[model samples]
Target: MFFDRKELTNDQLVTFYRQILLPRMIEEKMLVLLRQGKISKWFSGIGQEAIAVGAALAMQEDEWLLPLHRNLGVFTSRKMPLHKLFLQWQGHPEGYSKGRERSFHFGSKAHHICGMISHLGPQLAIADGIALAHLLAGEEKASLVFTGEGGTSEGDFHEALNVAAVWNLPVIFVIENNGYGLSTPVEEQYRCSQLVDRAKGYGMEGVRIDGNNLLTVYDTIRGVREYCVREKKPYLIECMTFRMRGHEEASGTKYVPAQLFETWGRKDPVVLFENWLMSQAILDADGVERERQRIRATIEEELQLAGAAGPADFTFQDEIADVYAPASEITGEIPGSDRELRFIDAIKEALDEALQTHENLILMGQDIGAYGGAFKITDGLADKYGVARVRNTPLCESAILGAALGLSLEGYKAMVEMQFADFVSVGFNQIVNNLAKLHYRWGQSADVVVRLPTGAGVGAGPFHSQSNEAWFTHVPGLKVVYPSSPQDAKGLLLAAFADPNPVLFFEHKALYRSITGIVPDTAYQIPIGKARQVHQGNDISIITYGAGVHWALEFATAHMEIGLDIVDLRTLQPLDYDAIRQSVMRTGKVIVLHEDTLTGGFGGEIAAWIGEHCFEYLDAPVTRCAALDTPVPFNTTLETQFLPKARLREAIQRLVSY
Candidate 1:
């Protein structure tokens, strides 16, 4: 697809071709660097450089841009130093701190880039939030987010777009259709003929363009950017591009159809753009040769400088750098308010309080406005905070999360919500790759909070019932908190918003209304990464979180004959390993429990850690009680059978007998 020629000039077209070729060479050099053991992994936007550079150039400094992993060219064209990028791949902290070397998967704040998260779809939704924040703050900034065609299939994509369109968010969504998600081709990804066509379902504008043609990509992005800013509507632009290399440095996808690869290579966007530039008389033979020579020298100098830079200070003291919020200085007394509200209501209070306390705080989610959010966590927020601060986003989770990362760099504290925690899988790429590692990779902070209504008891079934704490606990730089009571929920939620690093805050659906406690009236802050001892017993310790905490306590009370101490792990990340060891030391026995499947649940990590650290104190093997490895059955009886319960009367009895 081509844009009408009246839009772009010959000079602009020539520059686009030159920029595309520059990054292509960089990609090839990085590939060689990886093969020679100089770098760990190389992600080159060799074939798709036009789209990245075009969209990036279209964005103004104040406006936001969230690019995907393969968009390093975007950062470079925007003035990111190549040496810094190389240093990042070489595991040098200074490399990322100085330049935009951190865009491999996670983004860098130094360059006004958003936190690069591995989760795919959430960035779209976050873009909605950024647009809303600018509008609400009465600022003249627009927001743009980039993703792949494969990410468009995620439910979060639909959710983000639906919300953004309904609310008329000033956001642009760019789909870089490189044709493959890892090894799965776009044909195998979705039945839809075009990724942009799905925008009709959300009542938004959608267009497909030649991603490799910088003129087309730039014109399309500039139009959408202006529309989002002026009309306050979202746009979906699909840039049909290609990837000329393997999925990752480690991947050798032998399954891709040979014919398809050859066809894509022949229509390479970089070559096509160059050919177009020559046809347009923007460059002669000598000019093209000179431009190529300059790019080569730049690359060589960048590599030399990067190689000269030594390794990072891997000392243990450096580990504490980004662990906690720097401004977490305890203010005297945070008086509690006397509002006896529902769990979701407390969430609203916390969000408002955060926005009031921190100027950077921006909120975005699905149906979160006059619609009051999917669960009303943001009821009346759009009206009160204005459409900018209280943004209702499109259904694209990856984009939402990615945009939040970008918005965060502009010094905005962002809180993006997923309709359900189960749907977080859609944005898993943003979470694992970007949010969790951005601070570490880029040597910058990402103060972002993502709240999801999680857990199974509500009968939401397999799609909505997933308790995904285990999926995130393994990721570094992310703190996972699941509160069982409204009081704990409010306190932990506030704490998460106050954190410097990204956090996953899950409010169990079953506890939102069914449970209530004496929560403080106002913003009562709680420290993260600290476990609360709910009960004391000399016999054994039951370690759990979320819904399981309540059940474990109930089981302990019901079987009072067996003295069981319950440890509520309010924060799953940066786990209180010392507290666990101390509890084990006192009781000489421990049992790990969770609601997720037994195979790869958080319990496995806990059990292994305990086995390694407190093996001598254990009176028995570290036992874990969890749900069976099966999708949450729709039948109540089957769910009950499959779910984890504290009928620990038997386990307790067995432990005592042993």
Candidate 2:
């Protein structure tokens, strides 16, 4: 039953008063710091503190909280050390994000709180993933996610809700509909009379409440939590409130109407709750004043401590620490017998072994469950591991990737599959902005491996076929793996899962069925940033990866007279510079080849690296052979001409005869 304001005990009222007061005092102190040149920026939740406090208090200690920058009251209610919050504001090394992020861009694993990125709505899907984890683990806990009215308009918001509804996930989505979305009023944003009304479309229960009413906010969220836990369903609560202050400390209240502030100013949540307490004789005016003084003193001391704590000494090495897994983890060579298998089967076997070994590993993709993915690469995984671990998701690429990030945060390693590499563009924002930057931004490990079925040989057109490894290679925090042989494919995937960072595993569609090699039956991992010298010779150096490796091997075997030193770069991000240098120095000539467009393929990166580091060892200008600057055609003749073996052979001959 929902509790009335009068029903709350004296201790409960006093506790709520303190929870609301803490964030108010903190925001006020931060504004002072902003003017004093001590802090950089501040996003205050001055008038909306009640919503944060109420929702946080309603949730259990173990239930996860996905909070936005304006939800400081939630942190206060959760008993997050005030000094840590101050340290975060000061960007101290001891802060939750380890001095990497600013403001509220921090999370605590101990507290079960997932920090948010500036791109607001992605957290919605991430919260769903956390809820999914809870469901899979049979944990009786729900995830409480906070977003604003502006965030509701984002595509991820709808996608998160839809997925939660379809899967019956336990999540309570709270929308703090505080009149303005960074100066753009609600009426200008969406025409709906009430934001809660949109929940009908997503098949979830929706409720609206006066956000300034602390009792109502807390009771509503408490009830929602019960319903979610009991029914395993998602709920949305739209709290009506106003932004009394500007978006940030630097932004003045000029954009906000003077009348609106004056109207909301009278309905201040802290003052209203305090007045109710006094009316009930729970706490007199003097008691409230004493409480305020105590909070002010506490905040002052915490801020002083934080100010004394200096900034962290961050080096470039620290910034890129999690880019690749530690070499020590690979240990000795993989001990096992070899079995001849197709490239597709090798990848499936690797996934099966990983699932069988690690309880935290999960596979998610479209058609991966019943249909066994687009290429049947994950054919029997669902049947073996059950649908929960091997999940089939809706055609929401961005949401799927965002959920993978959340799953990673919750200590699960997610292997997400993009049916085709070209479709990765649809989810490019999450991959680059969220997945790639998590480690760099907050020192948070994104243990996600995105399996992309890439490249073209069959009659698949532009939408189905693409070689987009270069895009991920450019991202600093991501590890790019494209294996040519079945052995490398199986080994590298195992390495990726073991790594702490995000890895983009590019599985060339052309090599799936056509390529077969001996793969170890026992569990093993190939080192991520090392290259294999497939063929050793001294005349010319052939640098290639993925399907291009096969082409290079074919050409080198055909022309035995020309000694070719072929280097197959299994990992693209951390290129084997030592191997490349030695081969180029010995051969004195180099040929870079790939299936991507010649203009901006990863080959260009290889050529540039060689030019910068191996310039003295060069005998001839480095030559690069790649696909023509056009989309892959549907016609077989044109497709064959598009990826010409003769072109690569001619380039090799020119380099060899140089």
Query: Mind giving the per-residue lDDT tens digits that candidate 2 earns over 472-570?
Result: 888888889999999999999998888878899999988999999989888899998899999989998889899988998997788898888999999
Roughly what TM-score does model 1 have, to 2 decimal places? 0.76
lDDT of 1 by residue, 1-658 (tens): 2434565577766676677788888887888877888777666676778788888888896576777788876777777788877776676766554333433654555565664456566667667656766766677668888888888877667767776787677778888888889888887898888888988888888899888677777777887788877887888898888787767757875767788678877778777766656666777778788888999999999989987887566655566665434648434354555656667667767787787787667787778868987777788767777776777676667767866865666567888899998888877877787677666555656678999888888767898888888899888788888877677777778888777779899888877887766667777777777788888998988999988888888887787877788898888987988889888987887888789989999999999999988899999988888888999877777878778883455666677877
List candidate 2 segments past 4 Å from native. Answer: 1-3, 322-328, 334-338, 644-646
- Top-scoring candidate (TM-score): 2
Name the best candidate (by lDDT): 2
lDDT at 363, model 2: 90
